[model samples]
Each structure stands twice: as C-alpha cells, then as structure tokens.
Target: MSRLEVYDLEHNYVTTLANAYNVGYSKEENQLWDASFQLPYDDPQLKYCRPLRFIKIYDNEDEYIGEFRIWPSEKKKSMSDRQVKIELLDCLHTLTDSVLFGYYQLNNYKTDYVFNWLLNKQKNKRWIPGRVDFQRGFSYAWENENGLVDALFSIPKPFDEDWIMERDTTVYPWKISLVKPQTEVTARIIEGYNLKEFTVKESPQKLVNRVYALGDGEGVNQLTFKTINNGKAYVEDTFSQEEYGLIEYIWTDRRFKDKASQKASTEGMLRNWKKLQYTWEITALDLMKLANRPSNLAINQGREIKANELRLGKVIELITEDNEPIQFRILKESKSDIDDGKANIQLTLGNVIGNTGTTIADVERQQEINTNYANGATNIVPYIFDREADFSNPVEFKFFVDDDVRNVNTCELTVDTSHFRATSKGNTSSPQTVSSSTSSAGGASVQSATSSAGGASVQSATSSAGGSSTQTSSANGSHRHRMFSPGDLIGPLPETRYVAYGGGFVATGSPNDIYTAEAADNHTHTVNIPAHTHNVSINIPAHTHSVSINIPAHTHQVSITIPGHTHEIIYGIFEYANLPSKLKIEVDGNIVPIDSTSFERFDVVPYLSKDEDGKATRGRHTIKITPSDLARIEVQLILRVFIQSQLGGEF
Candidate 1:
C-alpha cells in the first residue's frame, strides 16, 4: 500500500508509515489541498507530525501525489477505536499568517514583479517559494487584497496559464505552473460506463446579463458605456433577458481610465449569461485500479487508484445522463472510507470558465462580473514613481560639473572697492607713476627703486662737484609693472563666487545662464549671494522611492483631496494599494481611529470616504496622519461612483 512520509523543514527524511489507514488527499479550486488519515493510537512517529514538518502522500505505485503542511497539535482521538485522526494543510496556507508589510499606491504594476516581490521580500520564514517565473507587462493597479491567496486571485489569469499563481505537485513544489486540466491528458468520465454515480446541478445563482460597469470618475463624470451604447448606460443580452427576466450586476473597476473599454467589457459579460451555470457531482469509479488487481475489493479500488488521468487541473470528457456528451474538469474532490477497504472519491465536475492555471476553473472569480475586467489594465505605464513615497532621510540631489570648463557670458563685474584691488599681468585700467632722481657732489649713496608703472627708464649724467649722479624718470616699469606693491595687498585668493539657481543659475536651458556662458569677468571681488534653498537639507516625513520597502512601526500624515460622492473604495491591506497590512487611518474630524492588523488583516470599509449606505458621503474629508518612527504610509485612495445622478430621469 502507499504510505505517508514525513520530512523536516529542511526536507530531510524524518519518518514513514505504511500503516496509516483511510488516507487520501483532496483539492478544492483556488484553495490549498488537504489530507487526513488515522494512525494507530500508539504510533511512535506521531511526534514527527508537528507543525513546520511536511507530509507527502502517494498512491500504491508510490508515485508523487502532493505535499501538505502540518499544523501544530491537531489530532482527534476516538476512545472506542483508539485511532487518532490528523488533518493536513497545503503549503499555501502558511500565507494566511505571513504578510506583506506597508501600504502601497500601485499605479500599474507588472504581472511578475507583483508575484516575485510578494513571495521573496520582507516576509518571515513561514513559507518560501521554490521557483517563480518573471512575467512582463503590467496587469494590476490601484487595488487591494487580503492574504497572499486573495491578492493572487485578484490578478487575472495570465494569457500564459502556466504563469498563473499556482503551486507545483512535487518538483519546485511552490512554483505556479498548475498540475491539471492539461490538454496532454487522455481522460474520460462516462455515464454508467465508468462513473459509479453522478448528480447533475444547474443554477442561475451567478448568472447575469445587465451589467452596470463603472470605472474611475465620480458623480456625473464617472466613466460608463452609456455614451457609446446609444441611450443605455448598460448593455442587455437578449437571450438572458428572454430566459431569466433580468439579472442585474454592478461592477466597479477603478482600473479603467475611460469608457470605450467599458463598452467592450459589458458586451463580453452579456455573452456569458446565455446559459445557467452548470455543474456535476460524481463518484467516478477508478477504472485503472481494477483492471488487474484482485486482492483489493473492486469496490475498494480507491486506495489503489491515484486517479492520474482524472487529476485536479486536468480536462476530461464526460458522457452524462442519456448519453449526452459534455466536457468537464475535476474541480473539487472529497474522499471517504467505508468499512474495511472500500474507499470512494467524489469529484465535483464543472465546465466553469478557467485558463490552464488550474483544472476546475480555479482562476475564475467567485462573484459574477465581466471576466474581461480580470484582464487588468495592460497600458504601458508612463512611469511608476509615486507622488508620495517613503524615502530614506537626507535625500541627495547631485549637481555634476563637467570636466571641460563651461562658458560664461562676456560682461563686466564690479564689487566693493575696499575688498578688491585693480591689477593685471601687463597693465591696469588706470596708470600711476613713480620716479626718482639724485644730484649730489659726492657719489650717490646705494639706492634701490621700484615702479608701479611700466616704461620707467634710467639715465647716467655727471653730477656737480665731479661726483656721478643718476636720474631715472619713465612712464613706469616694463611688463613687470604692478600698481600695488606685493606688501600692499594680500591676494592669489580663490574665487568664492557662489553660484545658485534663481539669480545666476538657470534650472532649464535659457538665455543668460551661467553654466553656458562664453566668458566671465576676472575681477577680484566676491559673488556674495543670498542664502539658497537648492543645496539645503530638508525633512520629508511621508515619502517613498521607486522601490517600495516596509516601514517600521510608524505613522504617516497625509492630506488628500477627497470628493464627496457615492462610491466604493477597495484598498489592499497587504503592503501598499496592492499589498498593505497593520495600517491605521484617522480622519481629522472623526473620533475613532481605524487600524488594520499587521500584514495579515484588512478592513475595506471606513478607511477612505464612504456614506452610511456603503457609498461615500458627499463632502470633503481630510485624512489625518499621525507621527511615528517608521516609513510613511501612502494610500492610493480610489473613489468609484457606481451610479449617475446627473441624468435626472427614471429608467
């Protein structure tokens, strides 16, 4: 018989039990797979079944079925039989506790960046992903979701179904490629021919034709299909209205930026309401298990059958009542063991909408709406920078000076004469002279002379009383002339002309900008400027960068323009708009402060603007920000008005 194997967190073999009875694993669409079995009251390896350890289930062939997570100390004991029953949870359930920290204001996030970021960042070791495929193209925006599961479900099924958020059966167990509804499988569930028993169900519970699709704007400005649909804001399906009177549904998708797309979506939704939803519950006998096996009861073939052909996520042909042919896929499966060895597997088969991500149309929304909205906005994001972001302190704006010297405008410059002296290499603006001559009977005493002007000369002549006398009188000295003596002034001082934006610096290219000037006057004076703000430090409490990160336990203050209108506000409580957790929002005029649980909980109502009727009350409301020591929180408040008031007419 197939056995149950236990592995530690590291996947090292811990224990194996071939003796477990009534063992089977079942799966539900979009939910984690579950399994349960009874062990003898005195089993020794029961200790290995604690939380964090993993359990693997296999069929009699011992081929891989799937892996499940264990919860701490969940065991049921029947005193009369002394058998203990333990239930198993799939690895995805751990996401229920793990959280993405912070509030996000997502504009248009790509399909893969959303997944990779959630699975690999700012989370505890509660769960880890084995593999993640990077998907290009932005698919989601301005939305909020709860657990990782709910957040993932909010994403539309990728065109490549393999890229949907799903887990593997064994290899790379946490990767998304689904295991079933696969085109490669050849499986059939035929009436009486193979099905042990079957129940057919048809319901109009989720059927709809009149879709009231609403998008981003509020009040009369709300984007709707009315303009393009002649006179009706809502499009009607003739078939559904004929068969079921009228089924009305409201879809508020804030992601839509315009009306034309809403028209196409409404028409698409009209097409799906043609028929009532259909489902089939069956207890299909395991045909492969009884082909040769004789030891196990033909009725008890469940234990011997892995149901490989009818595995979850696989598509199968079903010949129903009256030999009517229809295609269905296994969506949900339940197991039971009756007396000795007779085991039965009940399968919930449905032809629901689905991609290849999971077999039972697990990717479909539980609610009725235009599935087209699931194809989230695919417009190329112009940019992803948020106006309000959580930024690290001391942000730096660099001013890079180029290697080559920049040109300056040719102009005259002047400064306080007391703080400057007029002098040049060869000449000065004004010339001053110094000349000296001595006539004496005796030879002239040793004398030294210097001139502040160039062109000063010396002449030799015989002095009176037969003593030689020299006379020097000229315009000034030669090229070595200077107006000020070296001792008269202290210079060679570096230029301290402060360059700033407004006065001399041009933020953008324009005439008279200092950075591009051809020439600058070289006068010895200071370019004294008023204190400037461009190079000063500033503290912005609520800010963020292109890369979003988790903030510590902190509060952020914000003031946003919230219009008073009737609308629906859905915000993610994971990290940001897409993922936010442990968040708090307090309006200035309101008394009660609202806080969501840390990373794991979400409360959609009362955060933004809302009225008593679940729509927002008309009026401006201020969102108050408190002070704290963590990253500032930014909320992408999306207001969606579902009804139009300006029409002023009855339908």
Candidate 2:
C-alpha cells in the first residue's frame, strides 16, 4: 500500500505504517487492524514508483473537456492495483461556507463529466496542488516546489447535439424554437352591387386551398384559393367574404341561373337599322360611244351628245334642231362610285332626221348640182316656129331650202337659150322687108329672143344655092377654130419612105425601093442584091419599132424591128410592140446602087468548126429570137438556106 500525504512531513509514520508494517491487527487472526502497510494514499516518493491513472472528463453538456492523470511511475502493478479514497476529517466553518456560498462545492465524479480542484501552498491540502480529475478516480502527489503537478485526462467521446464548451470547464445553453401564426379571411358585398361574397383561411406559410362565395341572383358558388410564392391567395373582385363563408359553411349552393329565366328577366337595350332612297343633281355634261350608222336618220354623224344629271329608272328628253325631240330611258349602270349621288346610266333612244322630205340620196345629187352649175340641167324642149332650132344648149341651175318648215321648196330652174328660136321662110333680119303674111319665098332664119324669166333659147338658119337667105341669131360673135375631118389632104406625100400608112417596114440595107414589088402577095419579099449574102442589117425608125409582115395565108403575123441600128438593117422578131428587136450583124459598109439586082436575101447561119487548130468552130445554126418575140418568116427558101449553111465540109 502507498500513502499519499497532503502537507506535514512529520506524518512519516503514516507512510512507514502503510509501507513497511501493518499498523492494525485483527484479534481473531492476530493481524494489523487498518493499515496494510503497502503505500500511503498520498506520498511523493511512492508516486515516483506508482503508475499513472488516466482519467477522462466531460462537462454537464457531454462535451469533451480535456484529460487528467497521475504522474508516471516505476512499478507496473503498484498504481494499477491501488485505490486512494479521499476524505474530509473536519470541515472548517469558513471552508464549508466558502464552498456552500457557490465559490467551491462538493461535486460528484461522473464517468461523462469533469470536476476541477483548486490547491494552494498556504492551504492544508498544499502538498496536492491543482488538478482536474475524472469521476471515481484518485491521484496523489506531495508538495513539490519546482514541478507542474497539474494534469488533465479525457474520455474518447463525441459531443452531444447543442453542446458547447470553452476552456474545458464552462457550460452554455441551447437556443429557443420559433412558432408560426394562423390567418383567416372574410368578405362581403353591398346592396345593388354585381359582385359575390367570399371567405378564406390559412396559416402564414400554408395554402388556403379553397374559398366559398355567393353570387347575386345566382346563389352561392365554390371558389378555390390557389397559393402563390409570396404566401398569398386572391379572390375575384366580385366575391364578398361573408357570402363566401356562408357558402363554405353549407355544402350545396346554387351557382347559376336558368338561361330562359335570365334572358326574359334581365334588363337590356335594343338596336335597329333604317334604309333610304335619294335623288342626285348634276351640273356638267357626259358622253357615250355608239356604233357606226347607229340610226338611219339625219343626225350629226360622229357627233357626241351632251347630257346632264342621270338617275335610275328615269325618262330623259333631248331635241335636235330641224328635227324632232327624242326621249330615252335609263337602262344600265356603271361601277364608278360617284359620291355626288349621280350614277352614270346607259340610255336608249330612237333615230333622228332632218327637215327636207327628200331622201339622203336626192340630197347628195343636189349637192353635186350645186357644185357644177353649167353641167347641171338643159332645156331640150323647142318652139313650134317653122325654122329648125337647136335648143340643146347648156343651162345652169340653183337650189334653195324654203322658209316654211312644213313645205319642201322647189328648185328655181332657168335657161338662157336665146340660142333657140323659130321663124317663117319670108322673115328677114331687116325690118324694111317685113311682109310676113304674103309670100314665103326665101328660106328664113329666125333671131333668138330673150325672156324675162330665167330662160334659154336656140337659133335656126336656112339657106339655098340661088335663094336669098336671111340670117338670125348672133352673126358677129367670136368663133371657135374649125378642125379638119379625116380624108382631107393636109400635105403632099413625100416621094421617099414615110410612116404614113399601116406602120411601114424598112428594107434591110439599100433595097430596090420603099414600095413593094408588084404590091401583090409577094412571098419572096427581097432584100434584093447579089447572091450568097452573109448578114442583113435593118434600121428601125424612132417610135416605130415594130413592123408587121403579112404572109397572106400564114398562121401568125410576123413582126420585126431594129433598136437604133446604124444602117437601119439590124433585124430580129419584134412581134409584140413592147419587145424591140436587137440585132448583131457583120455588115459590108459599101453603099450599093438602088437597083432590084443590088439586093440579096441574106440568110443568117451559125459559125461552125475550127480553123485547123484545137479551137472549136461553129455548128450548123438555127436563127433564134427571144422566146417572147419569135416571128415567122414568109421566105421559106431563105430560112432553109440559113439553117443549112452551118455545115463546114464542101457540100
């Protein structure tokens, strides 16, 4: 056993008693009574040989404060098997009061809580300095002047919820819990108001879920108060809370009225529409396009009509000067939206005419007569006097429209045929010889007389070879030059060629004469000359290109001409007057005598054969004219001889 002493060194007896000897003996066994003499509960030297006792401490709040233990020792089992029970011998009044006064107090050692001890050198427990100990554990150490005897131990633990500590000794408190409040709703509607009543209830953070309300005339209705994020629910403006609460208090409540009842009972307004018809005014003119010759009347052709106001289903009247008035009816409409209320309406009317009863054709003829008066009308009627008269003289006429609209005016026709008269055989121009009733011996001409009316006259003249004649009419007026009638000789004929008779023909070269030989049917009309002639040239006169040669019994007439030939002998068929002949001939220019023997029938032959070299010569030729102007020749011997002359060999 070990003895742990607090302060007095003279208390070594207690130490020796507990260490070397058993101090107490039992009478029954003859052993010591109390001291086992192992070691003191508190001893500085024993503590050096004792093992430490580790102690864990926690506060009242179950928070791990720290650790406490005895100092280290040399012997292993010495401190493990030892126990030191602390005790108080005599409690000092001051010490007890100080502790009871809340400064210091007895504390029970707990397995889960800590106890702190205060030690000072001046106190009785001076040898034992300060300590923090675990519950149910003891440790000891005597006073040491220069050692840290203070110790702490901790149980292996985690702190409880809401537990906190400071400096391993102090304790603190937990925070308080909060509470939420509930809410309620109320609603109402005033008299004559159209809205309903509503009610609601909820906690500040909870949903009201549903609301109830009553509608006017329609009874009560159920409404829901759906919540929003801000912990609010809104009822419709028409709902009052009391009515809504009444509805929620009672389950079944009317929410709608019958459709027929509402319609018949409810107050509403009426509406209507009206229709009208009106007239329009016009102050300007309009026009319409119509077809050609629209009416067979004397209206202004191609002229446009001027109109004023036009209305639907109305009659319109218009007049034409020198004609009758026309009435029209509006028949159709146009689409232009004329805001002036005047609509463009199509109209139809009858034909219009002019004043004269004459037809339009008659008027046209009168128009021509008004243009050329001298050629208009003539006085063909004659007087009955014996001397013949000529009354078919020219007379002029004029026309006019009468002043009376109803009557057609007759044309004022007049003639000045003072050129027409008649007379007896004895009447004479001299007044001294007037004995009209006695003898009609001399054939007499009457003088033309004039009338006051627009009139015409004709004159007659009579004459005898041995009878005295009296002349009348104008005997001294100007006269027109007389023209010569045909067959009257105007000049002496030339002895040479002249185009006097049927367009004459010219002889090729200088022939025998211009007259034909014998003037009979001369088939061998000669270009009379020496024989074996090569070519003939014919010269045609100006404006006399074509000449007809009559072969008394041939099928066609053969005509020929020359186009400005130098010797008037170039020749080809020029039958049609429009086709003038063109001739190419090699002529002998020597002038020959104008004898019948100096002429020849020059037959045209085509050149043939070559002159010994490779050059190609002419073939036997047929004289040709343009197909449009081929003429037949009456001299067949000359024609055949011309065709055969193209052969080159001696034949």
Report the lDDT tens digits of candidate 1 across residue range 159-252.
3233234566465335553222344324666565567898777888868878787765545555576756776788777777888888888866
Tens digit of per-residue lDDT, candidate 2, span 209-278: 1222221121111111122212322222122323322211211111111221111111110000001111
Using alpha carbons, what is the TM-score of model 1?
A: 0.47
Number of the top lDDT candidate: 1
Off by over 4 Å in 2: 1-117, 120-122, 127-651
TM-score of each candidate structure, all chains considered together: 0.47, 0.09
Output the number of the TM-score-best candidate. 1
Give me the displacement of residue 88 in model 2, in angstroms: 12
